[model samples]
Target: MSSATSLPIIFVEEGALAAANLSAAHRAWADANGFTGQRGRLLALPDPQGGLAGHLFGTGPVADRPPLVAAQAGAVIGPGQFHFQGASGDPTLAALGFRLGAYRFDRYRAGKPAPVLDLPAGADADEVDRLVSGAALARDLINTPANDLGPDALDQTIRSFAADRGMECRAIVGDDLLAAGFPMIHAVGRASAQAPRLLDLTWGNPDDPKVTLVGKGVTFDTGGLDIKPASGMLLMKKDMGGAANVLGLAHAIVSAKLRLRLRVLIPVVENAISGTSFRPSDVLTSRKGLTVEIGNTDAEGRLILADALALADEESPALLLDMATLTGAARVALGPELPPLYSTDDELARALMAAGTASDDPLWQMPLWSPYDAMMSSKVADVNNAGTGGFAGSVTAALFLRRFVDNAAAWVHLDIFGWAPEARLARSQGGTDQGIRAVYGVLKQRYPAA
Candidate 1:
């Protein structure tokens, strides 16, 4: 695509290509040029002086697709300033998607530069920039291989990231976690050669509304002693996606200076196989002093989160949020795009859904069903890591996590898939972090800096 800044974009719907308000000459030119507005089609018109007249981008019905569909046009269109003609959707979302669509990893290989696009009229440039930066940083982190981003590396990454922004960062590694009383974290991570650690980051005024975010940082899941199938291990690198998302959301919050004391807790570990690997049927104590029996060591994400969540719950922050690539049942129920959200408060859930809808980062709310809570009961311990029944795996996981949370005014848990199985307009087919943007939206609404 040519990097010409003067090109204009004509938004055409599949059902209204011919009926759109186009001039006679341009309409005739479009018809002659065989532009039918089918999705992913682009048509360019030439002016009398042999310069570019304008561009035609085909899109689906306004209600059928997400606002980021404009990202497809952004990906292919000429590098230039583009002003939409006759588009009826939110211009701000379109611009945001356009900027997102221009992303490429290119860490190990060089790629073409992204074409520059001017912010659409009435769009908040600063907001778009923040989101794009946060999301891209998260995506890059998730996409990195586990070999390059182990528990130690992840800790250093968080420390460096927070240090650059002047946020206080600390971590308790190896045997230190045991002395710190984070037994579940130490138990789950003891098998890996790389030591397990808890990464803590804090920022903002102590007197402000307290908000805490906890993320599962299992760097790689070989499923511990209850190993996953060979196929299942392929994407285990993304198990720490929750940590990446929290970092991304943290970036957005701190950058925007939202009026809240923010704390990020991540229990970084590698669930590797070794002589000392935690076994299925082993009972481990947690920071909260709850005894959890390991029905399946593969279900380790929640075990680590149990200790971290207990720590976060101690303070009773105003709002507590935890995200994890926790359960496959979530993907079976809602598929890849819609992450499942579980909240303790209805008002908080409603607000989050509204924010997600408003920001085009929607999530589906699932019940924290108490009936399934019994499935996690253990004869030898207070609770079992794996459920007795195979059904409602996602719900059972949420219920187990809920057991660790108390005293917070509002708490929401998101079981995110954290990977895009296939490529989309703005998202490449790799480690794709979900639900953070919507969460950020809700946070901004509830606690915007004065």
Candidate 2:
């Protein structure tokens, strides 16, 4: 649509409405309407003919306003083509937020059509599309129910994704997991009707710098023999959010055609209760030859991730990253919006943090805290899968996974909630993507297109 016909979105900073550069008539209208530029406050502007002309959106104060605050416009605007007239925030992030805010998970129900937003000037269209596509894929996968997205289903989905991208994909299933030295993965998922599997996907030029990603793929966490309470099981379907998010990040990297050899490892399983369910105190051998004592069957995400991380480390990739919805302690430490990042490399962590701030994906760095490693000691095995004191649950989980990595050049781990407890400016109240955008931003910087 032409700029003349499209609705213009005029952003107003909080407490600056009086000096908002509005025409005398429009200013009078805003004053009469008591528009104070409160965050998320939207006021419709009219032309001389009493017809719709534009909209006034409050961005709140500059100091506290988020980069994606412009996303609020996408959520509130009706069906029409709109463009930013005088937005003061980062234009690229604003445009990206506008697109993200228009996202909806309507697979099981009908929803309204999304309003169109003309791409703002200076925004990279390709980059925006890549990020949006990745986020949507992750959200859709996380939002799917367990009944339809079990281990086998997840395996198939990954295979299809690989095929579409021309990536080589393979899976080692059921008894094959044991044959392949993934005893912990088999033990954790053996009880379920759906067999456990480890999915591997490879893409890009093998001669390029190796970048490996591992994700915990517990499709549905019933907590096995240590079943979770009914309230905890309510959102168990999202247990595989880690796998979903990594795939989303992978998509962005491939779509951008970054110069790196990418490898993705996902240990897919369902922590279900059955006659063959793995019990607490069972010592299971991992892919890396370390025996892990199951302190609590509910702590199964780390178990599967340990095996995958071990496999990734074996290649000694230049960069190793893993994402998981691992511990409740992480949530207690830093709510759902901010995922905690743990890295062996300080430079990598700092880069990720900066990228998160710039991309509006926000990540907080949490130390690996080597002192907490003792909390996972086991009397009968190499290590216990759960913490002893329960004081540093998240720290101990990160420490447990660290035991399996010895060869990677640099490694980073993200403990993400993967769910939005409440609706926000650019995010819905359901499954969402975390940390991927920040990681992608860093990747773009590290491995820019040739």
Candidate 3:
């Protein structure tokens, strides 16, 4: 429907409910239904003829308003083209939220039809499309079970993604990873029936400022010899959420045609239990030539990421970012909704935090805590894959990856849960995207289109 005729969604703040410019009859209807302007509350307004006219939505206080509050409206509104009136907050984010709320994982079941939202004025349609598509891609990849998305299958997905985008893609699979000087990746992934692989996807101008992304792609973490309990194993399928999120971010960057060289390195593996599983106390050499002792086999994400980050650091990319579902300690520290971000550059950290706040993809900066680096020291090897003590698990893991990234100009590591324990605003209950939008925002700001 045209903007002039589209259903209007009138936003009302908490205290301003009495001042909302509603007609006498509609005001009576709202009063009769007790439609106070509380956040996430929606009351459909009826016309004189009793047909649907518009909607009255509560947005709460300005400080308490969520970036995706419009998502709630999208969820309940019937299938019709709608436009916002008296909308608060960033109009672009509200439009994005509406689109995100329409997302559903229908791979195995029927999904509901999404109500259309008229593009808000000043919102870029391309930007919204890129963000939505990227997020959907990440969510889909994370939600899929390991049986359907192992190392080899992930390899195919990356290949197809590259091919579709005209990007160059390659992989070092199985024993080739050993030949390619990625022993740690090989060791961690060698136990699975599906061979471990390192996926490389490159795009943008070669001579442009380099930005590299390294993501942990443990398709499923059975936790190998240091196995997890049945309860801990339930969500292991989402372990590859890092790879999925990187792919999503890459999609946005590439789609926007950002003027920078981009490289994505994913160490795809399945840490499964088998006779060949790398055992605890086994020392393995990484791509950077540092020997790492496996303090716990469950600490395999850092091992694989070590090799990938080492490779990315070789070029000394202007920005090096890695994402991983690496440590449960991160979840313990920040809960499932917030991811911990560790960065060598304070300026970059600030920019990312600002961007995250702006995009509603929040990140909490956690220190590399140089003092904690000693926790990863090992007598048998150069470093231990897992920290000596149980304390500072996420910090130690980030420090472990830091060892292989000396050459990079600036490096950041995100310890993301990559799954939503429950539904919130625009986020669904299952596998979700974290930190990508924040990173994407930084990239867009740093490398604007020429």
Candidate 4:
């Protein structure tokens, strides 16, 4: 939680000797000091008193891919105020690069020593605030184990976050879920002692355009009766990634003080196997009144999201967005770097795509075709939680959720991995921030303050 990690970050470009244009001072330093400009090279310049003077890092000498300049020093660098001591006065590019380089998630253990970064002079304080806080929350949530981060803990985190912001919060827990008409949420969460609940928090003026955000909060996944292998269960603690992402997104929205009224909904549960666990053959009625046949006991994310999305739909919000680590198929299709986005509005889709590109948060849009509608067919219930054939599993899931939302002017569903496949500079190999920036960009432009 260091406020400003202002560490000096000077970049040395490689191949100066081979190039035609080179400064004598820069060339002299490079040749004498053996500065090859290889990525992530850390060199410290000390003062006359044997203290630190400034720090230097190596950046790959690619002209086209300048944004990735900070990839070398991101999370790997220790906490401090980082500065680009290079001659390039491109502060915006420097800030963008440094911001991308400063992310880290050391939840399993304490993060080792890395230089703190100093914020750039006149950096976008608001944007930086949202990015760091939201990303930290996401990482913490994804890094904890299921035993520690179950339904109750997830709800508690949300309550704590809401209270910190002075936002109003309400939760429908246990059988109260049934009484409150969140049967699916209960059915999915009822298996755990943590007791499933639908958490709703409101912020901003009541009369403002409602912007309801929903996230799947499955704290762990045993895959229910279907039970995944040990390898699959290893990372199941991150099943609540949807909830984490939503709360993370809400953190950004609230911190930025966006114009739209905000509401956050998280249906917290652990899809553990027990006699009480909902069965694959069983059918359950959702809050939206659509009866869903449980196609697979493990397909529990949709169950919780169904109840929450229905509630969001009821608000008739100006915009509705839901994020989940819902399918491996999506990961197979897009890998961990890009999340597949499903949206009903074309303009919104374009805007979000542009926003993602501009903000370094990339998302690819998948169609919400009506033809895939029948993939979720069920003989007894209105639909099955999963499609019979898994050809387009991600699309079918989106189709299943679409049943509950017909009124939202702009609705977007993000099937996010929430975990990075490998280390990518600021994005360490652990829990990662997928769409927070792109969504923030879109929201900022949509409701720019008057």
Candidate 5:
């Protein structure tokens, strides 16, 4: 494996030094520089002319799996392309980490260009590009403020994305939502001047297996009539993270030209406050024809998703997956990095768990416990938007969405935090695209192209 565009990357872990394999001159240079192979440590050797030379990236042992902090290579190395010179676990994942770690949401400001990677031997360029691009798109969407990414803007985005790929796309906006039977979506979004809408994009042959994905697209959550505290509302802009993740994964599927028919449904809305905002105890009819009493307006993500999921389930797709920043209890349960997955099918659960682990986009499985079903029972309607008690909030939310999904061969609901509360080695602090890459990895394995 030789490349002109990329510099050589040598990975070293603590205890076992890989510097020993380097030429005596380079090894001596590394030792002179006090490079000890600790994780995230980088040593760049200079040529005698003080020009370009190779680099050393500190990482976990070779036996450890990838997504190893190879991202540090991008962060530390100067502008240029690079390739792996030695085994650092999975080269593909290492490349992905490098790309992801190199990411910067500089939409509003000018930033320096980061180092690039020459695709390594055995690494699929398309796969790595698709995954990194998907995550990058999601991160950009989430990081953008609500003022610029409202429901109407999101609608235009879906249209533009579909147009570029020659996919069928449409939006049922404002009052049309009421006429189309998506009452919950309209109810949640109607108060905003922006108007609520459902954005739909379809691709692939009709004869192929159907896979429908639904996302909660609340552009901003003011908590409607039941307002959130000023502190709580600060990060409300990322309420649309579910929509971002779906679009990201959809991009991967369509770009890779997978073997399944794909449909993306996003109920775009803004849970804003106004005189017309839906009130607490209000009974709203959903697309599924189920009536839900508003237990708490802040629990609005599930309302919009309920209607969209009902619409998607009507097709009895082979797979139905919905992602949402739906519950704080989920963050409490699994924290921000790991999204909780709810699914009844053990096989699908196993596959998703395996894919998530392998891809480093981890999810913890949470049961759709039937006992919690009664907790959402409403005195005035078919169901309550939220549970009466705070306990098992995430579980009850998953169960609530489950009612709208019966026809799909398999249904998985992801309760995702969608925001990284703080920064990590490769990931910057703020809105992150959680669980999507892992989901895409599963889809790739399940529906590989011929």
Candidate 6:
């Protein structure tokens, strides 16, 4: 079995026999072994001592995979110092996936976690440092179960993160929630002993291009009055995935010091059942003074996020982004690997798509279709908590939140799985940072100076 170590890998390509000359040790070996060098294949090369010269992996024609491909490749490669020698054999993907694959939830134990992969040849030292640090930070946040990662825990994490970078950090907890005028956030999280909190961290000069990030931080969701079944609750630990992803994005932004002024808003809560828990059909007023009729208590992620997004939009940040594990329909539409994104700006959508493709964090654009607006219309209030039958659950959810951000210049809503369902080459099954790298790429490219 391969242990966590750096391993060198190379790519092999097929060429014309009589038309071209191929004389490298790799090509010679491939010819003899009948290895056509297809995509994502790995073959062991000779070390002469046979101890392991390196890895000869195929990535089809160009020998390139998305950065997300790093997960599976990292999983299969030997865990020691190794680098890629073939086409674009830079260690970016390997390092990205290696850090991601190394994630594990061992919070209860005293055991030390996996060590960081030392950079191999061809890996950009600075880039590897930034990505690995961010990936590790995201994994640490996700791997912690709800038991220890409740609202207050997330608050502390964000505080430390902000302080480390010399950014401003503030959190509104419990009764302070009422004082802060975030009544909805207070109502949703009041049931849990852990006080519900809204964490805000801002970096960069106020004059810079404004970028706002909002993440759903439901530390655990028990469906409130509309409780989920046992199987559904099994993975409730990952309910804070959106929050984890935001931290991932923040890490990248701060590490690279992207030119834009970045602001992060996370509403941390645990949708627990208690005598004080809000019930279905109960009316609650948000920070913006819009009364929301809770149609289904299980649809709580949006509730908490509403207050955060309103807070974010109040500034009319140049870019407003909120990410959440908001709907099952999104997963059904795009599966776990591809996240569904809702946006009004076509150019922004294009940029996000291109960034997703280039970074290997692919995103699919789903319309905030105006027609679906009627589906969420509530008789008594501005909007219903959920759709009547859940035909376009993702669309309806995005529409619901859309009401809160009318003030923002540009807005994006990501309904992401944030968890990998199974392990593929360079990816593993568990709490994953879905669509994170792509968003980072998009934001950094749009505003490159920091």
TM-score of each: 0.93, 0.96, 0.96, 0.91, 0.95, 0.89
Q: Write the per-residue lDDT of candidate 6 for residues 342-416, one digit (tens) a residue.
A: 897879988998888876678989898879878877889878888886698999999999988987888999998
Candidate 3 vs candidate 6: which has greater TM-score? Answer: 3
Question: Scored by CA lDDT, what does every candidate get?
Answer: 0.87, 0.90, 0.89, 0.79, 0.86, 0.78
Predicted model with the maximum lDDT: 2
Instruction: Write model 3 residue lDDT over 1-450, tens digit each, in one string.
Output: 237768988898887876678899988998899887888888999998999998998888888787878877776677778888775567788889888877788898876767788887877789989999999999999999988898889999999999999999998998998888999889988988999999999999999999999888999998899889999999999999999999999999999999999999999999998889899888888888888888999999998898899999999999999999999999999999999999999999999999998788999999988999888888988988888769999998888888888878899999999999988777878999998889999999989888
TM-score, prediction 3: 0.96
RMSD of 1: 2.6
Report the CA-based lDDT of candidate 5 relative to the real structure. 0.86
Better of 2 and 6 by lDDT: 2
What TM-score does prediction 2 earn? 0.96
lDDT of 4 by residue, 406-436 (tens): 7788899999998886877557677777888
lDDT of 2 by residue, 1-450 (tens): 236668888889988986678999999999999887888888999999998889999888888898888878787788778888765477778888988888889889988888788888888889889998899999999999999999989999999999988899989999999889888889989999999999999999999999999888999998888888999999988999999999999999999999999999999999988999999998998899888888999999999999899889998999999999999999999999999999999999999999999878999999899988888888999999999877988888888988999999999999999999988867888999998899999999999988
Clashing pairs in 2: none
TM-score of candidate 5 relative to the true fold? 0.95
Angstrom error of the Cα, residue 383, model 5: value is: 0.9
What are the runs in model 4 whose C-alpha is more than 4 Å off?
1-7, 13-29, 32-55, 58-63, 66-68, 79-81, 87-93, 96-100
Worst 10 residues of 3 by lDDT: 1-10
Selected candidate, larger lDDT, 1 vs 3: 3
Across 229-328, the per-residue lDDT of candidate 5 in tens digits comes to: 8999999999999999999999899989999999999999999988889999999988888889999999999999999999999999999999999999
Ranking by lDDT: 2, 3, 1, 5, 4, 6
